[model samples]
Target: MSKKGKIISLNDFKENRKLTDPDGNPFTGVCVDYYDYEDEQKEYETRYKDGKENGLCTRWYENGQKEYETRYKDGKENGLCT
Candidate 1:
């Protein structure tokens, strides 16, 4: 049988608690959030695995400058962050 999966928006992914991966495991992917209202710029972006942060996580300032960057392993900081 061929593997199948569905791509959903970040909001849907977060709002739905029963989403799963093609393999029947918890879904995993990248999520980017933006500031609300007038400042509609990207606020941050992060990687997720099994519903938890498991890779690179980056945040930005409202002005669009990179505020910080870090790596995560199973939702925990695992490497240098700057």
Candidate 2:
């Protein structure tokens, strides 16, 4: 789906663990976060639904190695997280 609203910085979203549009609606999409050091690999990518994690969450190391992957349902960890 299209990005819901004004783009929010990764840090800001992390602090609250919730994302909202300018109108205060829950955000739904892949939230991609990157390392401070410039790199082609992203730090993480998480799928969100209604402002909470609802699908796969994947992370990587700065060297571009995949760190781990976790699944979530309604913001709570579920299924395999490896």
Which residue pairs show backbone clashes in model 2? none
Candidate 2, poorest ten consecutive residues by summed lDDT: 1-10
Among all candidates shown, the one with the greatest lDDT: 2
lDDT of 2 by residue, 11-59 (tens): 2555457766556778788887778535545898899898888899999
Worst 10 residues of 1 by lDDT: 1-10
Cα RMSD, each candidate: 7.1, 4.0
TM-score of 2: 0.75
TM-score of each: 0.63, 0.75
In order, the Cα lDDT scores of the candidates are: 0.68, 0.76
Q: Report the backbone clash tally of model 2.
A: 0
Question: Tens-digit lDDT track for model 1 on 1-82?
Answer: 1123254332244434333455466557776677753555888888778766778999998888999999988767899999
Clash count of each predicted structure: 0, 0
